[model samples]
Target: MRIMTYNVHVWYDNDGQFKLQEMIDLIKLLKPDLLCLQEITKHGLTEFVKQTGFTKVFKYHSVAILTNIENVEELSPPSNTRNYYPRFATVKVPLGDGKEFFLTCVHLDYKVETNRMKEIKQIKKHLSCLNADAAQVWAGDFNALTLEDYSDVVLNEITSVRRKNNWEMPKNDVSTTMKADGFECSWALVDRPPPVSTCRFDTHIDYIYINQDFRKIFEVTKVEHHGSTASDHSPVIADFKLIQTDDTEEESGDQ
Candidate 1:
């Protein structure tokens, strides 16, 4: 299976031009089996699906799913909080022949730490409800840099300073989403040749996480940082395979 995670920056390029149609074209070219998009507005989502022939999960929020393969069985919108937009969505897709997969698309809060924490908690709660046992892929613009980055006192201080200045500081931590003990970030687990910058500004924020139990079945075959003018944040692609199957059941597997 091929999957991608991208934060289109609402189809705005680094040059500050809004090219929603160009973004759609890029997604069509990738042709991921499942796609997780962030920063999508209602109009932009409609325009994307219309152009790329992908279906949008029925919801009133930014996160959307675009896939040429698989049938969408369920979609759960992000939990509502007073200060933040619904920037996350979860979908269950049937891979085929009774097999299925779970895809969670998320865009973390870009502002207050309190709000960011709340959003993460909400996301965890929703994922827990899904009973995601089959190959699960959680991807999108996390806004958080990495778990290591959160240890920097300077970064935390910068966040405090931004809060005082009425500027929203981006949360840079992976611990927020690791409520389950065995979850692992795909980029960190695989032996990446080296860190290739993804964002136009040369930052690595977007990511893909899979449950550790599924790691052996899915390998990070390829990961590319598209520096094209499609969107501010480059797209990430991952390939997976089913290595083992429980002989106990064939059709009614968990996803």
Candidate 2:
């Protein structure tokens, strides 16, 4: 399966012009089986969902999950929030042959680290409530960087940037997430360095993460950037292979 995550910056081209056809063309080139987008407008998504090749689509806040297959729906119940758009979404994705995984696509609060952390917790809690054993493929614009992304002293750069921006590093939250079992960034799977910039911010912050239980079940064969000028942030395209049944089920059978 090919999976991708892109922050379309509200579906405008880098020059700040509306680019529905351009965006559509870019997605076609990526040819992702699963795609996640952030910072898109409601009208933009509604239009994209209509024309994009993906047969199933779901959007919440400014985030969207697009898949080539059908039977995609929210993993958790919808919330009645008082915002112009929904802010979070997780979809039950069909992976073929009676298999599936939950893909959570989110555009976290960019202004406050604390707010983003709170939302992340709420998203995880929602997933747990829906299906405690659910496998996850998390992707989005995290809006924060980690100190342990396997880049030497690039670790220091994360802290330095946080200090420069005068935002307190959400240490406890970052540790909790990175330390979670079955949770690994897709970049770490391959030997190449991570993207230099995920968006026009000149920093890399977008990502795709798979939980521990699902990591062994899928193989991330390629992770690379797509369409340099399509959006402010470059879309990350990943080719993955699911080699086995869910580890949880396989283990239960072994016992």
Candidate 3:
């Protein structure tokens, strides 16, 4: 399956132009089987569904999960706290005939690293409560750099920029926390240089991560940035191939 995570910058481009139609067109062109979006509004969601024909959708505030697949089930969010609602959502998606995987999408707190870390923990807690052993994929705008992307040179540049803008210091706590909890970044599996910026900030923040168990089922064949001028952040797309099955390992996959 081709899964994509995109932050629409609230339907505006990097140049601050509202490109609702362009956004819809871009999604059509990409044709992701499972699409997760951040910074999306209600109006945009409605128009996207109408024009793109995504039959199933789950929206929580600005974040949403859109899929055209049938018989997939939407999972319930944790009732303990409403703090993460606006930025997070999840669904149980079918893998094949009788198998399924949990897919969670999130738009973490953008301002502070600590806040983003807290949100990651909340997501992990919620997912653990649902089912810990299920294959899982979590993707969307994390708004914080991963520690692996923070090299000596990149760290210097990022820190200088943040300090000058009076923004909080850059930290990898959010992605690190997720990594510690058993999630593996899809981008990391592909052989590529690090620190490819997803947003205008010149920092790599947007991501797609799958748990180790998911890796056992699907092989990440490709991961790339589907950049579009219509949005500030490029869509991170990952292609997966089913590596093992009860009958035979098959290459059948879709976007």
Please give the distance, in angstroms, between residue 165's alpha carbon in candidate 3 and its true position after superposition: 1.1
TM-score for each prediction?
A: 0.77, 0.81, 0.91
Give the C-alpha miss distance for residue 42 in model 2, angstroms.
Answer: 3.3
Q: What C-alpha lDDT does candidate 1 achieve relative to the native structure?
A: 0.68
- Model 3, runs deviating above 4 Å: 79-86, 193-195, 249-255
lDDT of each prediction vs. the true structure? 0.68, 0.72, 0.83
How far in Å is the alpha carbon of 246 misplaced in model 1? 8.9
Q: State the displacement of the C-alpha of residue 221, model 3, in Å, after optimal TM-score superposition.
A: 0.6
* lDDT ranking, best first: 3, 2, 1
Worst 10-residue lDDT window, candidate 3: 246-255
What is candidate 3's lDDT per residue for 1-255, written digit by digit as tens? 999999998899988899989989988988999999999888878998999999989887788899998877888855545444447889998766567898888888878988877777777777776566788999999888875665689889888998999999877787777788788889888964344778888778888999888888899999987667689898899999987664553433432
Q: Choose the strongest candidate by TM-score.
A: 3
lDDT of 2: 0.72
